[model samples]
Target: MAGLGGTKMKNTWQQVKKVGIVHRLLSFWSRDWFLKVVSIWLAIVLWVLVGGEDTIEKTVNVPVEIINLPRGLVVSNQYKKKIEVSLTGPRSVILDMDDRNIVRQVDLSKATPGTMVVNNDVDHIDVPRSLTVQRVQPPSIILSIDKLVQKQYAVVANTVGDVAPGFEVKSIRMNPEYVMITGPGSVLSQLSALQTSYISLDGFRRSEQLQVPLDLSPAIVSLIGETSVTADIVVGLVVAVKTVELPLVVQEKGLSLLPKTVSVTASFPQILLDKGKKAKDLLVAHAERYGQTDQFNVIVTSQNNEEFPVKVISVLPRRVSEGKAKLLRATTKKKSE
Candidate 1:
């Protein structure tokens, strides 16, 4: 009972204080009814006029971002990456604006192949709500949309300059013979094959493995996945023709060549010829291989029959008499002494 009594007394005292405060407020307002109202309204009007006059206008560049782009579509033509915006707001707000975070987004979800003009609007810009966007520069932007194309192209290897003087390229090969590329249809449709950057073969004497890059302009097109490919170049010594006379040989007892020696033109690797090798040491002319003593074809072969050793190009007076065939053996034997 004692606690309840104390609580009632505290509530009565709080109510009395509240009533007294309200009575004084009413009395103060009643004292200057019309004049006080005018003064309060005038103060508000002055604050509004001063604040509106203190606003400033500023121009800023906001990066443009493409959003909601449809599938199988690409922006073919070059377009502005950023848009310029002019904004006006309270001086304090403009000075404290986070301009770096401002961005203008252009939506392309409804775009298709061809040219499209999208009008720039303040709604596209993201700025502080307290700041007002007065105007956006570049009333509109033009976009060229193209169908995204994907294709597989054969990789053609290209080489520039010559191999070493005595060397030649046997074959040029690429590891990935074909590549898949995705790009705008405008360019990809006109191209048939993709070529690699020209590989230099200057003074190259042996087979080599090289990293070759593709010939692609990033501004126009792009390769899928791989930027470069492995190149396998097969190099070999150049084959050269060498002409020399060799003594004709016949094993048959009844025949010999009319001319004791025959001019033989044969092909050899440049390295072999550089060694100053004698024709007789590298090759032999046998008339018996044809099994005919009269008017037989001159068969020339390597002495040791080595690999890629020799290739006969021509033989002067390729035929011989049956009786002359016997003289060839005698001439060779006589030279042996």
Candidate 2:
């Protein structure tokens, strides 16, 4: 009975050891264990799909960006602002990218005026980590850079409505006469004329200076100094005109006059006529010393006793002829007499 009892103990110990081994083996196949194995397998599968040998080559249009240009420098030529990028990477990564995800940037912080070719390098492009840049469609870009410059342009007053009745706008003058502007060279070349803010002369009767803003489009140009300019509107009493016939002195020997005598109308300040500066004398003097163009005009003295200003009001025949055959017959007859 003792031996049989010992044998039973041994058999129980063996069975217990066998059961423990079986439990250990079954624990390896539990739900948590299966989950861990599946996670590792999925990680390998994802690696193969995203970073592995299954790569796709595709061409996508990416925006070309210019950054950090030096002060007073600009791109002056029309160029392709976009580029095509050929990418080689996992299918999942390459197909999911759009223009927003990738870009080719050119830095012009140290660029100077001239033509330059910029190469597309990996460092200049931004792309996803999983994708490889096979090539850039343009491979390079050509840029024409120029220095921004300042220019002066005459400003013309744009007026609305006429001066008050019986009071004429004698003269309009700008204080500065010109405006200084700064812009890109190409843009400045297109701008040859400039205008001022609309001024209304409807009921104006007095000589006054007005502060008017310069009408400039801010998109392409910038004002250098003052944006507002002074417009001098001179108004005076309108003088009635007296008409007279005056002989023109031919400045050039071979010059011909269209008409022997020109009808001249003079509008002078009442005080000048009161002081014995007759309209006939002033008109004859003006016709005698008319030096600028072939046409003669009616002029008023800018100031007291000064030479007549070159303000041309009107001329009858708008043109002059060359050659002695068309010279004035009256002048010839007077010379002969």
Candidate 3:
């Protein structure tokens, strides 16, 4: 009996061991394991078919970058800003590259003051390790370098629009009439002077003083002195000239004038003329009250108000005939004396 029981226990243990062996074998062929093997094999096959020792050419635009420029020097000419690069490299690497990955570098550290021609090649360009440079559309570029220079230029004031009706511009004064500027010699040599921004004088009636900035280019030129200037504008009163006719008045009784009117020229403030005041309203003529003869001198005066001062320029007739001129008849009855 004991032997039979031991045999039964041994068979059971053997059966359990066989089950464990089967489980171990099944673990190697599970769903996750099968997927991993398939993915690796597919990746290898695809690599061999698509990117194995194969090269392709592609054209891309790369920006030109300048570096290592010497101090106090500038490039005066605008050359090719971008270049087309034809690259021959592995298909896998070329397909992955975008416009940001490639760039052409230009070294101007040793440049001098002259026209220089630089060649484009792989040595100066930055690219991926797997890609090779085949050709460049513009194989060379020309640049002009110049020394920096500075000079003083006169500043002119510019004004736009007109002043008030009764006022005129007396004078325009700029505090600093000149400005010092620094820039490339090629551009600075051609510049003569600078101008201020347009100053609007529209509806200006009084003297004005303001600070105005100068108009200058920011890219290539720099101002060394004060960027702003003090503009002093003076406005003065305007005088208007006008002419009018006034009736000649006789003060003495029984006195009559031959010419009833005379032309009077005067200068007055422009403000008074624009206030609906006629030139004739400000003119008057007077005669002497004690004059015995009919002829008298017509004195012209301006009746202008206190606000408007009028200056009499001229009078058409200084003397007037009030029927006073008569030929004394010495009873010439054929001189019947």
Candidate 4:
């Protein structure tokens, strides 16, 4: 039983917006390059020292971008997403700055697949000499690197809360059934199947369709193509009904039943009715032993059947003639096994 359960960009890929590696790069530069170049150019020109201006300190957050990382390796640890730089510069120059285009670049040209720490310096910021670097919030970065690998794993739907009160999750279907991901091999090896983030079943009484992201650890892995999947969850009743024919017998007062078989219909808990369970395995029928003479009503119960409870909904041929064919007595012949 289960019950219910940011759009931001960083140094890591934006999951929802990233279509693929090639498409993302092309679209990013094409859409953003012109504005970025113009902003930097204007900021540089205007940054020339103003003779009599007062200097002030300002802090800005700059996005971090990783470059030149080898294709065979991936960073496995959480690194700085943004560098917070506090700069002291002329008031006029600082006010004219558009830091949106400013990015802190981290180069991995000489990097290998292992744990490493790198220092973040004030020089990484591209401000003119008029601005002096006062401080950087995080002076150093630590990262774990591992061999990059690709794998495909089956997808599972996840949910929280019980579906209504008398309902069950009959089945779960994923549109693509599986997911392919590119990530660090050490982390990928620990996973067998990818699971979607939890969806709510709180008071939900019927099937529904949902779009959910995979439950993945940050910085350790990245989805290859589709970032989220379509999930179809089926809900159904908790009880099941079945009809079966079983031999009816009499065990008390030395009496017998004439038509010694019956068609019995029963309702059973769906939780206990898997492939190995059957009507005969959970029900027994016999002629009633009480409250009648020469004629008895058929009694059905699941008494000796694994202590599981069953309800008799309908029993065809509800009564039988006793001691005759006309009321012919049922007989048992003893023999050697």
Q: Top TM-score: which candidate number? A: 1
Please give me the total number of clashing residue pairs in predicted model 2. 0
lDDT of 1 by residue, 10-46 (tens): 9999999999999999998989789999999999988
Please give the CA lDDT of all the candidate structures: 0.79, 0.70, 0.79, 0.75
Ranked by TM-score from best down, the candidates are 1, 3, 4, 2
lDDT of model 4 at residue 210?
87
Question: How big is the RMSD of model 4?
Answer: 28.3
TM-score, structure 3 vs. true: 0.50
Location of the lowest summed lDDT over 10 successive residues in candidate 1: 217-226
Model 3 lDDT vs. the true structure?
Answer: 0.79
- TM-scores of all predicted structures: 0.59, 0.42, 0.50, 0.47
lDDT of 2 at 312: 29
lDDT by residue (84-179, candidate 3, tens digit) is: 988888776788778355678898999999999999976667887777888887999999999988788888888999997888898998888776
Candidate 4 lDDT over residue span 162-220, tens digit each: 88765688888997897777778888898898788888888877789888887766543
* Model 4, global lDDT: 0.75
> What TM-score, to 2 decimals, does candidate 2 have?
0.42
Report the C-alpha lDDT of model 2 over 36-136, residue by residue, as the tens digit: 88899999988876557577798888888899999989887767888877888877667678535577778898899999899987556788777778778
- Give every collision pair in model 4: 2-160, 2-161, 3-160, 3-161, 4-160, 323-327, 324-327, 324-328, 325-328
Which runs in model 3 stand beyond 4 Å of their true positions? 1-50, 53-56, 99-101, 160-166, 173-179, 197-232, 239-337
